[model samples]
Target: MNFAVETPWVLAGLLFMLWPLFDDGVRHSPYPWLDILPSDAFSTGLTVLLRILGMATIAALVLGLAGLHRTEQSIEHIGHGANIVLLLDRSNSMDNTFAGKTPDSEEESKAAAARRLLTEFVAGRPHDMLGIAEYSTSPLFVLPLTENKEAIQAAINATVVPALAYTNISKGLAMAMSFFDDRELTGSRIVLLVSDGAAAIDPDSELQLRQWFKQQQIRLYWIFLRTANSPGIYELPTDSRNDNADAMPERYLHKFFTSLNIPYQAYEAESPDAMHKAIADIDRLEHLPRHYRERIPRQDLSALCYQWAVGLMLVLLALKLCEVRR
Candidate 1:
């Protein structure tokens, strides 16, 4: 408890209350000889008691006027979970449903399905520290790692817009990696990347990304949304020519992630149901100890002081009413 007032000097006026102990206020009474009687001893003690109560009431009122309160403290909470980052791709191809992005279609678009399922995923995990990032031509950090489910769901909802830009996977990965900086090495930290297409990464950039992931000891999961005509990561080219390798981008991207020697998994989702299954699998795979802190705001003590003052004043009022006319 502490005072928050600008002028605490008013507290000095409380000393004046002690003056009642040394002298009674009565000046010239007609029956001055009655003060020397032995029977008046009880009345003398009562006067002292009433004076002390009055002083206490005045002191409480002064303290209340000074504005007393305590400092805010943080409440630390621990649980079992992981730090997961949702890396979503906003390429134009993702705007379509798993069947196709055709006009006047009744099926939900891939982006819409993702938004709905991710919102559900966030709602289920009360302990996990989750973050969101969306990438098109560049990466955008939608939210930082936090236990705030509402904010995370809002970021996922905002990603449902049309995807007119091209996918930049390398930059997206780089942006996701930057989030773990200065974060404590606790629990199971992982990145859940969701995308429908893949792009090539330069050899220099690939080496740096691999080394960085190894240093951080982070896990990666790619929830690949397979379209109707796109080649899957496991499918091999029918052509014998060596140049056919370039046509299978997903395979090379999967190879690069595996070469990092870190924990990694890839799931191919062909429909909305498959997408939900993939997220559930990721949920089961990533589980560990999670530590977080929440702030508890300060509370004021002025109200309690005022209550004490009011109670003491009521007692003094009762004492005065019972006093005799002498």
Candidate 2:
């Protein structure tokens, strides 16, 4: 709401406003019996009024040239919502249906179902500041955290594009964690991971991720899209020889998250309806009071100044026409 000028030097033109006050160069016709005329107070007042209007007109013109504008500002907002980051997996398998095959007219791909449900989730939360991050072979920063619903929806819809070959979720989680950098913890901070598959994380990366979760105190939620005939997070290998991180990555990843000692939940979704329900549950759980600042963009006022100048000039023209001549 504060005002500023782009070119301060142009304001010097406002000095021209004094010209109307001091200049008495208007021509007058000679009158031999001027001393016999009676005092005219109305004319004297009208002359002063006209000079003031002239000064105002000049001042307006100078201000218009100065590029006046309102500076950008940030205002604090409080609402019942959480700061959430949508950490999505964009691997090749996400392009298939829940049955692990290309979708036909009767079925929808996992990514499509996720995009639809997440769009609805965003629409329902009016005050939540959400960010989008996707990971395939590497993590991609899609959008920053903001209260703009349209932008969040657009980023979700764009996830339906053909995905890459691999899923490096460890790096993706790191990127999602980075979104909260320099952000105040005024409310619940949640990381919602939507993925159909999992990959093994190196020991070094795993240690770093654990430290980050401890430092940030972030809540984690994983919506596991379980394809038909695939092993679930809770499933145990029948033979003890095959129970390792590489063999059952989904289970180990879940175990790693549980050991972090932060608030964490995992939902196994085998169909579109299950995905919808999981998203709904998340919407219900993240209703904590949040406080954040929203920025307002700068607005130019030069056009307003010019409009005022034009209006005053029209009024002065009308008064000039009413003057009586000798």
Candidate 3:
């Protein structure tokens, strides 16, 4: 534990401690009768002890005036949580209700529901390191992996419906994967993709996606916000009849993600309740024991020194009050 002071000159007051050695400060009384008592040595020792205490009291006061303090170093905090990257879709389609139309009732739009639920998710994971990225025509890394809950929620809330005419899921996933690069992170690594529409990726991007997930050992999840009358992941696209029709973009994308040799799950959310359940399931599955670091800043110690000085002075006062009348 290191100590520092605001005013070093105040320490000169400690020189008074040497005064006791020169004089001993014991007065000689002229009464010859009392001088013969064997109390001389005892009186000398008591005077020395009192002078030392007096110097200590003064030192404490001087240190308090000098503003003493100690610095706090960084510390490690352990917890059970994951490093989660929220891959959000900001395509214009998300601005509609699940019924596939602009929201007319008090019902929330798909984007609004996602933002609200994700805000709740971020708040609950205090120890987790989280990042967020949004995509429409391309990807935008909104916030880097961190434990700052406020910034994460603010990024989520700030997302506006994309003006682009496409959903670039490939670029979005690639950006999410980039968050884990060079990071010495442990615990469950995840990429939680939330989208209401789908678009196919190029063959090269798909190969890169597989390699990234496998190399980083990241789990993948897609929360498909299903609009009414749209083809679900398991169903044939509207344009085709056969099961092998890679016709529907979502179905093919789902197939591709599942084919990767890594933990993956896709949820089809047709309503707000289903959306909540999907997020809750992800929350339940991602927790695992891990260690994280926390930095605590330096704190002032002047008040503590003042407290000690007051306590010592109180002791001295009590001793003086009980002293003999002479």
Candidate 4:
């Protein structure tokens, strides 16, 4: 009582194997299986038509499946969610040394320390998506919004402290926005911007960036690594930015974030523990509070399947022509 349509190629292959031995062109003698076939004029014509139909079907099936795979890949990169783009400045100030947990040898600069912290940080952040944009003279996506924590962590840790690399905050922010624009997001978006300072940028660039941030409704937060003028931070055996300097670095950062309407915080690392804590603070701020929303409905694919079915029917016509002359 149960019946179902078979796959086009499979059905064609089954018919093809049987058709060659039973068709009218197959010279009906005591021809093995041909005796099982009917000689009724109506049935004989029907069988011949189906034999030709089956061959055309097999060809259509092969091409249709290939087309499906191509379309799937072409549309694969579309529709991602709102993401956290981590923007970091890779200028020389990033190279100042700091002490790690055990202070003996010289520690790494803020950039290196942050990278190290990111390895463990990514392990805990599996639900949220994140991207990274490194800035010096220009900005580039070292990693895009991805759930692959290991790859993201490795890329982050590999970052280098400046050895006065160019500092281009304006360029970095704009590039991050462009990357995020490609995704499909319903949740509130944010950008976690970690930088030493942007004392080198053109004045108009920051203003333009600030306007863009406000217009887009993206949250921006700061993590300032103190090398000089920052309190409780000293030039220990470890290297650091603004180490034992004055309050200028943190103060300037506060004003910058304030002007952009971004929530701001600072961390001073004369050593490693302090640097680790800074990264921890960033992980804390990443919790996005939002309203629960409905999911987008799955796209219907039956139309595509129907199109394949129609294309196959057309190919079946070709077989009728191939044998009609005979």
Candidate 5:
């Protein structure tokens, strides 16, 4: 609730003003406001004053009102986000390189690229609440919605090589929704889906997911890594799945995004420069808005004038009854 107190105390001003006018003219002994009237009159005034003050107190509490003020838009508080969730894909395809990494050891999977991009996103948005999930044969909860970016990054790093064995897009969505249920969600809830698109989810399931996301008002983002044309596919690990060890699962993934109304883009290059561009693009989507957050502008409180109204009333009413107060 917005509030303001007048710079010059109204109570003090009212007391001084009433002093010369009423204090000198009145000298009807102690408890004189009551003395000026019959016993019944004093009782009625006291009762009326108490009743009015009681009503004011009740109004303030019920409305969360900072007294009453005319409606004015103040930009003091902007982009104070309520909540958001990052639904990242962690299937075996994530382990496949879109743009080739060092191409040695367990270091350069598509998942790694996505994580690096996520780090950039996290670095820029310190205020955003985020969570994570790794989906393949099924999606696994890596972290809950938290402000601890370091903890979220650590969990992402710990995810090891996964089999492009199976894809559970539905389960991942369900898990993400469950995270919101565990906490209180208020403003723009979002899900940034970073996928290599290997899973072949059913049409019905995909439509259901889309409807659910729309109803829940969760904004979906698609960062589809172009694995079909990348350099590292031949080197991809395939126990018996590929003759050439081509680990990229291209068809199902493309079909998944194209079917959804979600806006999507791809990282076409197979090098660091291309990967950086993809990261930059995503950063703009999430971070640019944050960067422009300052544009919301701040407001100098004007409602403070009304608070003085309350104080002034109290003071004048006091002076009018000062003799009786004693």
Candidate 6:
């Protein structure tokens, strides 16, 4: 808890507090035959207490004017969660429902469903450092990995816009992988891909992606949002001739991910409920104890200072009212 002041110049007013100590703020009167009167220790103690309260009130007012506050800080602790990056597909197909039609009043689009479920997933995992990236023709980096829940939720909610041209997942995966660059390896790293379709990656890009996954030890999870009559990640072609990358891109993509020799899982979701279940499974699987840093935002202390000043002023006012005059 680092304390700071926004307006240092206002602290100069603390010098006024010395006035109470020097004079005690009391009117002096002459009394004859002072030697005959015994000293009253109770009156002396009350006067001293009143002087201290006066100085405290002045100090509190000055501190309030100075805008005292605590600086933002980061704290590290052990937690049971992973550092996950969500790689969402923004291709045109995601704008349609699971039945391959524009969403109507009774149904929601795949993108909308992903956004809703992802938001809930983020809320549930309070300790995870989550990031978000979207891919269509190219990868769009929405946010970096951090424990800021509001920013993560906002990034996920922003993905419901109209779809882009195509899905270049290789580029998206690369972008997502780059998020862990220069980051502390304190826990499990995961790249979660949510898409309705897949695009074939070139031979050179596949080699680079494989090396990245191996070197970083990152886990990959794919949530394939299957539309009507669409091929699933495990579905094989009838003829061996159609078994190539171009024919069954989703299946081949899944195969490529598995070939990376890293932890990988794929889920085929035909409806919103299936997507929810997939997210739930992910939430359950990534619960490993690891160290993570959490940020605490800056806080203002001026209100507390003013409250102290007001309370002291009331006490002084009561003392003044109770005083008797000759």
List RMSD in Å for every model shown.
5.9, 3.3, 6.1, 10.6, 12.8, 2.5
Per-model TM-score, in order, reads: 0.72, 0.85, 0.69, 0.56, 0.50, 0.89
Ordered from best to worst lDDT, the candidate numbers read 6, 2, 3, 1, 4, 5
Tell how far residue 227 is off in model 1, in angstroms.
0.8
Q: Give lDDT: candidate 4, residue 322.
A: 57
Give the Å error, residue 287, model 5: 5.0
Pairs of colliding residues, candidate 2: none
Angstrom error at residue 203, model 1: 0.9
- In model 4, how large is the Cα lDDT of residue 290? 32
- Of 1 and 3, the candidate ahead on TM-score is 1
Instruction: Point out where model 1 deviates above 4 Å.
Output: 1-72, 103-105, 242-246, 295-326
Which 10 successive residues of model 3 have the least lDDT summed?
Answer: 237-246
> In terms of lDDT, which candidate is strongest?
6
In order, the Cα lDDT scores of the candidates are 0.82, 0.92, 0.84, 0.58, 0.56, 0.93
List clashing residue pairs in candidate 5.
4-304, 94-111, 99-270, 136-166, 197-253
**Model 1 per-residue lDDT tens digits across residues 1-326:** 33364346876767867876775433434864764666777776877787788788877887777766665766678987888889999998888888776634569878888888888888888888888888889998899988777788888889967786788898899888878888888888788899998888888889889877987778999999999887888777777563243677788899889888899999999998999999998877676777877545677877887999999989887876775565
Better of 1 and 4 by TM-score: 1
Instruction: lDDT winner between 3 and 5, please give it.
Output: 3
Error of 2 at 325 (Å): 8.2
Candidate 4 off by > 4 Å: 1-82, 99-106, 157-164, 182-185, 228-250, 289-326
Q: What order do candidates take by TM-score, descending?
A: 6, 2, 1, 3, 4, 5
Q: Among these predicted structures, which one has the highest TM-score?
A: 6
Error of 3 at 107 (Å): 1.1
For residue 181, model 4's alpha carbon misses the true position, in angstroms, by 2.7
Name model 6 segments beyond 4 Å from true: 6-13, 33-42, 239-241, 303-307, 310-326
For residues 176-294, what per-residue lDDT tens digits would candidate 3 score against the true structure? 99999998868889999999988877889888989999999999999999999888988854444644424578888888988998999999999988999999999998889877776
